[model samples]
Target: MDTANTMIRYVSPINPASFPSLSILLLAIGIFFMSWFIVYEVTSNRFTRNLKKELLVSFFASLFLGFGVLFLVLWVGLYV
Candidate 1:
């Protein structure tokens, strides 16, 4: 049992505006990268003929990453 390793770590409360800023930053980055990936996929591969499917996959991937980061921030409390 590592008692020393477990404790309430917090320097301050999360600002109300920080959440929206994080969301916006996350979305902007997601869109930026998704655009590049979609363009690259379509241009590099001839088999990927369906734009809808490419978009769907990219959207899901962005969502998954965003949600994953959100969950981690919520559960772990980013900032110690």
Candidate 2:
């Protein structure tokens, strides 16, 4: 038997509560950007689209939103 050669490792889990401020900030920024994006889309002319502006806005909105939601879930102890 080679049981003596076996090794065990322990890893500490992340605690979202450690950075509540960061989570809140991200959520707020995400919502703000998303709202503006919606308004822009609704009011802007389809035929006169500005691809650069739209892409930039949408990218930031999605990025912040994804991270914000993820952090929020983790903060609430939903380890999904």
Report lDDT per candidate.
Answer: 0.65, 0.81
Best by lDDT: 2
Best by TM-score: 2
lDDT of 2 by residue, 5-72 (tens): 78566453654555467678888998898998889999989997788988998899899988888878
lDDT, candidate 1, 19-78, per-residue tens:
656656666666676776767685866774677777776786688568546744754557
Task: Work out the TM-score per prediction.
Answer: 0.43, 0.71
Off by over 4 Å in 1: 1-13, 46-80
Clashing pairs in 1: none
The TM-score obtained by model 1 is 0.43
Off by over 4 Å in 2: 1-15
Report the lDDT of model 2 for residue 55: 92
